[model samples]
Target: MSEPQTEQGKSAMSEIQIPEMTGKVLACVDDSVYAEAVCDYAAWTAGRMNTQLSLLHVLDKNEGTTAQNLSGSLGLGAQENLMQELAELDQQRSKLEMEKGKLMLQAAMLRVEEKGIVNAESRQRHGELVDTLIELEPETRILVVGKRGADTESAHGHIGSHLESIIRALHKPILIAQQSFAPPKQIMIAYDGSATMRKGIHIAAASPFGRGIPHHVVMVGADTDVARAQLQEATDVMTKAGFEVTGAIIPGDADIALAEYQERENIDLMVMGAYGHSRIRQLILGSTTTAMIKRTKISLLVLR
Candidate 1:
């Protein structure tokens, strides 16, 4: 009788487990509309994982005062005798920049808490954005950033170099919020049967990040024999980790399949490797990774 009750309680707990996303989630906010959307995505994800959210804004001194000083010394300065006037101009610019940074940071914090997550906070940082995020990677379980930057010039191509740096530098998973997303309905795992993908699957299945979430394991391409074997292997992995897994053999390019599947199935997140086929191979085919990053509208969880 006691055993049955214990089992019942355990099952009940699993149903309400949310995402088991403990620890703090670090979200980078900038002056873009997408930044606040990113914060919303972070709060929703944090609420699902039952985690705290930390909003970060980097002042980027290189883009501000230091750059001006270096430029003035490098002959961009006026040849007129108003050296004192130039210095005063620099001082005013610096003050305005600092005030703008504070306003942006405060706004992001308010948005995060507006969703009622209860653990949202903000931090204003100075220096390179990617460097600061990487510095806090040990304590950060997940890093959230906007898919495209606030600046229209920077938003067009691939996600800016800063996002690329954060993705490559840190081992923690990153969630890129596109448009906007609430709680995930059904999530997709990009299981390629590679060692890194295997690690990603294990993390999703066993970690709190996947609590109570239904997942579809997609094996892309036409290797019937290999795909079958890999699918079975993934099944065993998830089974051992105690997950309800549904899988499919998707034909065509992995990138195309990912985007289409997200739209069709409403996959809230796509979990896959940042780079696969070893470090050397990853360097060779890194553009495919970038292509996928630009193409998807749903959130992505990229593991190193």
Candidate 2:
């Protein structure tokens, strides 16, 4: 016979039994400036895809460790008392953070509802953001997140530390929201002839996210015959997919050239491959992908 279920085991089983809500536009929310934008973009996406919007707030385990650290420095009997006090304090702090997350998720739900997502849902999980996202991946249609979180809000030009990890961890398409939201009027694809970028092109072609938006397939390199050919191929794919396609070849670095084209054409969203180069090459020469993510003022739709 099977062993009798413990309370904890029963709780875990209940969690597992919760129905997977597939085709949700999952937006990660926090006490950050970008949280509102995340909601807005997610609402737009959900509306476009005719799906539900789900907001997630993760209370990172690494946060609130100061109490524990302070308890570690105490000595003997005082240390024991301090440890107990610290443990209680840590518990209180965790509770407060979770409450704060609940409020944040409520506000996000309201924001998205105002944008026409009526049946939005909110969830709060205690763990690393990446791990929470990974567990929720099966239910997610597309993951939307802000470029920076509350912890990294003032650190201009740097993405949230977990941003890259979340991108690498999940297979679903990620929409990285900018500081503000604007309904996309035009979108630019930073296309290269690489297999990764080709896959991105196909994803863009099929996705409802950019349907009916004029697409600019911008390739940054020497305006060589090969570059022209590659640009044409990308544009042709998008055109065949029913987008109004415009192909261009600009001579400059990828990040700089793409940003320039975006501003020049007033592009609202950028679609591109997430990390086309090897980690070793990226470390040695720096990553155009990271630079573009940092520099772009518009929202990004990053495909793996």
Candidate 3:
């Protein structure tokens, strides 16, 4: 973990008036296969909103500290030599990682620029991923991140370890990119009439993010009259906002129903309120937000 930023440092960061930091669509990229998708989705969003795009790559501190506590059972002089050699090796590895990050960022920049995003910029930082994103939260309008990282590529049905932490740490809207990108022709808003979901609906209605796209307001539960009424209320908000809206009250588990509806409707993006329950509660009884994130194949736009 990195040290917390000092008040003075925070103030300095606030004062640094970079034009790109204001309302920029920030995308976090790594060497994972989803990095290209993240860049592409971010480029599409930035283009739609007419905002600047920024790419961020965070180098985890633990990734560079593999030499610690490895000098076991060696003669004192030999141990010292080995420790020195390991230190040099660590330095070389850190340098290589830094160079690799630069190349990745360069490639991402070129990719977005090719998509007609000329104002795109990139940054490389050192620290944990969630911490880095929290520090940059002030500058971010919409944050784009991959569902899984390179470390978790083979682990099917598991989201990146940093994903939940990022959701918990930042208040900004996050877009979790899948393995591919396509412009969203239709979007589904997972609504359950909770305060958080209501806020999400309001944000979606007020913003131009998905203004002209067709919308599906889906609720998972028995198709009771009350459920229909709630779904209608939610869809009405979007309909009044000039969106072509369709409301559905499906049956079954929340995550399963939403995922099924999304696929059946060919929804390109699913927007929902993220983690409405407490962390401890979610730990005891699994989170639908996390489950949906893992289950769905399409990208998600999650609001806090």
Candidate 4:
């Protein structure tokens, strides 16, 4: 029903303001292809939500490049001195890694500034990334991360396979940043009328986040009266909240249908329920979700 965004959206979203429920936008940054996109999207989100932006870089325990060995030919006293030197060297290495993490944050911070995010700060932490995020989860409104990373410099490739774990662990929403960063003007809610999908609808409607962006509530299957009514109800909820809403009931496999619509309509972002579906649907939906995050062209905003 609705098409992609037009100039009408630009006028309404500037009035957006964050409510008390969510806090600042937290974006994970590292030396990877996804890092830049992540920062840009985070800035876009921070701008819309009227929240501060935080850049987090964690120095994992094994995120070291160089290795060291002790001299085997040394005498006992010489060995003791060598061990002391080695221990100090380890400390120095840790210090250098901390500095490196800080630099990465600094660079990410600068990148987002170009996107109009002025209230941004960077933090560096030691230990595991998941552990740090778990500790920081409560303070974050939404988490933004790269789907795949070539972070040869850090410990994360697909955030070291911790993306799923992070999604599973945190109650907060996560934005799986894709390769390109164009500020989302149009949003499509991949809906099934499920609880989590409904929750995503309510959040998107109630929050100032996707407010001016036109939302297409799309479902896959035969366009039945039931599908029509379900989508109509969802559309009404969004419409009342000031969102430009429309409905689509496309027939086919869910993933394939949504993917085709995304390309055809030039959708920038897709919001959907996280971990919502039956056993059979979960099997079908899980792979589709993974594909969307890992391989799709659009950025995904997942709600738990």
Q: Say which candidate scores most in TM-score.
A: 3
Q: Model 4 compared with the native: what TM-score?
A: 0.81
**Lowest lDDT 10-mer window, candidate 1?**
1-10
For residue 18, give model 2's deviation from the true position in Å.
30
The list of candidate 2 runs beyond 4 A from truth reads 1-22, 69-75
Candidate 1 lDDT, tens digit per residue, 114-149? Answer: 889776778887787778887888778788888777
lDDT tens digits by residue: candidate 4, 78-188: 888877877788779888888877888988988988888887999888888888999998899999988865553244323337787787788888998876788787899
Sort all candidates by lDDT, best to worst. 3, 2, 4, 1
**Pairs of colliding residues, candidate 2:** none
Candidate 2 lDDT over residue span 244-280, tens digit each: 9999878777898899899999999998877766788
Q: lDDT tens digits, residues 149-217, model 3?
A: 999967779999889899989988899999999899999998877666666776787777897999998
What's the CA RMSD of model 3 in angstroms? 8.8
Cα TM-score per model: 0.82, 0.88, 0.91, 0.81
Clashes of each: 1, 0, 0, 1
- Cα displacement (angstroms), candidate 2, residue 280, comes to 1.5
Give lDDT: candidate 3, residue 270.
Answer: 95
Instruction: Please estimate how well model 2 matches the true structure, expressed as its whole-model Cα lDDT.
Output: 0.81
- What value does the lDDT take at residue 173 in candidate 4? 88
